[model samples]
Target: MILTFFDQFAIPHLLGFPLIIPAMLIPLTFFPTTNRLAQNRLSTLISYTSKTITKQLMLPLSQKAHKWTNPLFSLMLMLTMLNLFGLLPYTFTPTTQLSINMALALPMWLMTVLTGLRTQTTTSLGHMLPEGTPTPLIPMLIVIETISLFIRPLALGVRLTANLTAGHLLIQLISTATLTLFPMSYTLTALLGTVLILLTLLEIAVAMIQAYVFVLLLSLYLQENI
Candidate 1:
């Protein structure tokens, strides 16, 4: 019975077709194409908002990293849309999956490492150990720093997955309680329902914040490499 709630997170398939691909693609439909001017109010707003976000994200980055603006902007938009859509009834969250989060994190992390290695080999290797280290502590510090460096992608994936999973589970549990109590007590049910509404609103903010954070961290990593 406990597994029922988690089953919602599993990728659905039918007759050998994976549904997750379609789900991921659904967000693309909402975006306006660059072929036309965004004359409509909604389209204009979307354009302005996207540009503002891109600018903010690129502010701390060096000139070399500015080339990543388009890719990073699209990633943030996709992540934001997927997270918001997941809040709707009967929808699934792709970011809630560790594999999906890791897929997103690993390549970006590797790119940063590779860029650093290619452009600034000495600086990149220098990060593994501090200068003027005591002789006895040099080996231990290198091991610790190396472990931390390798753990970056794992940390990224786990942070996103754990936050979304915890929020969704709370929502499900509270919603179940509200429904189960309705017949016995209208007053308590109404109160719980109110709390659920507030929690849902909070989750919406969380969804957006988490998406921003994911991209912001990537930008920081890029900054270090460049």
Candidate 2:
């Protein structure tokens, strides 16, 4: 099926609200703390679903949040799935849209900030502040930090949106230019189409790069605070 921003949310919402946001574990509900010990016991006792639910029901929300390690990884996977599958001719790339990127980035920014606060490293907030200066620098740093913090998500959202949107549009524009010059020039069309095909491959690589950038920065932010 063709991918669109609405399709991303609509399909999941139709199924279950829980599916909209990424889950830490895929088949296994909560992450196993000790490893295969619980998995081995659970497997021998009853069905996997039964085991998963029982394990999940027993845990508190705080505990569950602590176990979540790969949130940015999950977001990257979702975005990758949307872009790769939708790259087929007429399908839309939701990654190319600001709305979708904002949705992804906004939550990430909030999570980053909240994580910093919870981890009790408020001094790490000084990254947005200046290095060394006089008393007058305090006001300047406050304004600068405020701007910097807001820009984090905005920059993240726009970078991917603009790159993907521009790349795809460029390919389309090139093909359209050729068509205008020689409407029936099968040779020119074939050559340009090959270029577009190559670009599509490049776009797949870019998808991975985008994911790495997002996740790496996320990890870096956590490391700084922790």
Candidate 3:
């Protein structure tokens, strides 16, 4: 039995061996099966779905920013797969950790900011102080804008981490309660089981949506820069 709810978030172990390597490798399974001239139904479906999603994602982006399409699409798929992997009976989710999310967020965010600064120097700095600002309030407004600018990556990381963590915790809580109540009342346990199933389904949707959101927001940030 798990000693604590948080322990489940920890790298699991078996016979005193940590499963971190396997956990890390699980995401590799998320990639497309193969690159063959002729494909089966599953491969065809994956191809169509990816094309559709990437097409929508790229719509708002300029041609100059179209280069980001692959990275953003891959990220969407990776996060979606990783999150879904965690829903299984035994698996760890790296995205649940703020550090990992930050590692993903900060670099992409930095790249966009850097791209903006390099290509549109005047425009980038102009964002800090809008065209018509009272002289006295300019200092305070600049400080606020700078703070907001730096907070973007942190917000991105925290958002993904918090959502997944909360969902996992709730699922664990409900599952535990269902097990505990099994002996007491068949009706109640069955009801809890039903709720658990529905919650899992909702979490599945959340997993996909959150991945899309992360990629979408990054694209929006890129849009502002490029």
> Top lDDT: which candidate number?
3
Give the per-residue lDDT of model 2 (tens digit) for 21-115: 34212323333455564558665553565345334432333343434444644565566666564456544555666877888888877776887
Please say which candidate is ahead in lDDT: 2 or 3.
Answer: 3
Residue lDDT tens for model 3, 1-226: 5569999788778899877667767788656548752468888887799899999999988999999899999889888888888888867888898887899999999998999999998898898998899999999999999999999999999999999999999999999999999999999999999999999999999999999999999999998888
List ranges where model 1 is wrong by over 4 Å: 34-37
* Alpha-carbon TM-score of each model against the true structure: 0.94, 0.63, 0.93
Off by over 4 Å in 3: 1-3, 13-18, 30-32
Worst 10 residues of 1 by lDDT: 30-39
lDDT for residue 30 in candidate 3, whole number 0-100: 57
Query: Weakest 10 consecutive residues, lDDT, candidate 3?
Result: 29-38
Clashing pairs in 1: none
Clashing pairs in 2: none
Candidate 1 per-residue lDDT, tens place, 1-226, comes to 5898888789988799977887788878876676665467777787788888888999999899999888787788788888888898877789899999999999989998998999999999998989999999999999999999899989888988898898999999999999999999999999999999999999999999888888899889888888
Compute the lDDT for candidate 3. Answer: 0.89
Query: Root-mean-square deviation of each candidate, in angstroms?
Result: 1.5, 10.2, 2.0
